[model samples]
Target: MTTITRILILMLIAVVSPIGAQDFQGIATYKTHRDFDIKMDSTKMNDAMQKQMMEMMKKQFQKTYLLTFDRSSSVYKQEIELSKPQVGGGFQVSFGSSGSDVFYKNVKHKTYVDQKETMGKKFLIKDSIAPIQWQLQSDTKHIGEYICFKATYTKQVPKVNLNFNSKPNIGDENEEEKEPEMEERIITAWYTPQIPVSNGPAKYQGLPGLILEIHDGKLTVICSKIVINPEEKVGIEVPTKGKEVSQTEYDDIMENKTKEMMERYAPSRGSKDGAIQISIGG
Candidate 1:
């Protein structure tokens, strides 16, 4: 071929090659609903105290979740909040925190590095695992003006417990002996293919589309708004210095925190008079 023709072909390839890369970007939302089946061990408490404690626990706990996702290459964010607030005499307590997670996908190396932030700190965890082992059904849908795809993957996420801070002080010395609680959860996601990005709101991705919605068996998160391919660039990265622990350890930490709080605030949580002096400062 002539030198001029070869040069022209090379330029053409350079201009159009990214399209062949099949890179698209879009956004989706997920909603989750959590249900707790808590049973107290009456064997551990006096009949009266058992009833009282069970009632107290039932009253204190409501479903909650940790929402985390990646914003860009190596950057992630998370929010932990109560799915439902406890209310009974026109009062409420709020427990919610926001954080982040990291994202790194080395397509060339076929490796993924995922990181997350908790309470303003960062932790890294395994991103590559058995490929979800899920069977899903998909349908095309629209979110606002965007043509998106929706899918439902009905499967159990086995129970997951995250023990962040576990320290025990008193009450129900044998509470640790009780069978560890397991949460059975289901997740549903809605996404868009228009953006062509294989990333979703959180650790969920690699689907046929960008997730616009996520629904767990207990809670639901809907992406009320989305902006794709903005003029600005976003960067996400992996976390460092986070103590590596199993999910059980995380759950233990959480449970320990719950126990500590209950003990410290027992008077308020247990007394009817304290209940009467409640305020839900919305």
Candidate 2:
């Protein structure tokens, strides 16, 4: 490294005051970008329409979020945007994607309480950060000013929906659909020891350093900026506004609610390709 570059890094370090082995609090801004691909028989729609739909879905998932953290507690939530809802295409189905909930985590206590207000009902999901068991590798890359190392892991998640007036599966209203079979997904993360905190964009942590970038192949979540101990004190407060319930209990509640909506809407009538297929608790 050149002497001038080393001096520049030192100056930058002094300005940011990166967290080390102690209690620290700050805010991190992240921008998440995702690509959406619908698997439908192309015979129904032309190539232009398909491309336009894909682009719209991609923009819907793209969002910015803020994560505030201390030594133990951290809260992650998405930034609000002013935009008109996408309409006219019919099929108003919600899929399994990243949410805009205030995810509060207590790392030292190994507990988390997320606050979510969905469909006029509030939920507080108190649970542990399900273990990921990441395999740390020697690969490294520079993300902005931070030197980050890569780690990968895999886990099973519930089957997701991308219903674009695609199927006539009455099974959606059936009880069996509630027990969605798990599908394994691979996750890649890049962390930097420069910011010595076990924190990341979403529910990812447990690494030796702070994760600057994370991806699950389909979606990419990366940090846009890191402000360490800014002029304003970062309030790392635990959210206690929603009705308390365990993670499993909350899932059951959502499933029951979704089933109720499916039945009410009469999914059998949703045969038209452009008709709205309502998905409750989406």
TM-score of each: 0.52, 0.79
RMSD, each candidate, Å? 11.5, 5.7
Residue 261 error for model 1, in Å?
2.5
Where model 1 places Cα greater than 4 Å from the true spot, the runs are 1-92, 99-130, 157-170, 174-176, 180-185, 240-248, 268-282
- Name the runs in model 2 displaced over 4 angstroms: 1-21, 41-48, 85-100, 158-166, 171-181, 266-282
Give per-residue CA lDDT, model 2, range 84-174, as digits (tens): 6776665354544335578888777878888887766677788987766988776777888888778899888877766555654555445
Cα lDDT tens digits, model 1, 42-154, are 43334565444345434433322222323222222433454454444422323322223444543223345555444344444444423443333435566776555555655
Overall local distance difference test of candidate 1: 0.45
The TM-score between candidate 1 and the true structure equals: 0.52
Best by lDDT: 2
Candidate 2, clashing residue pairs?
A: none
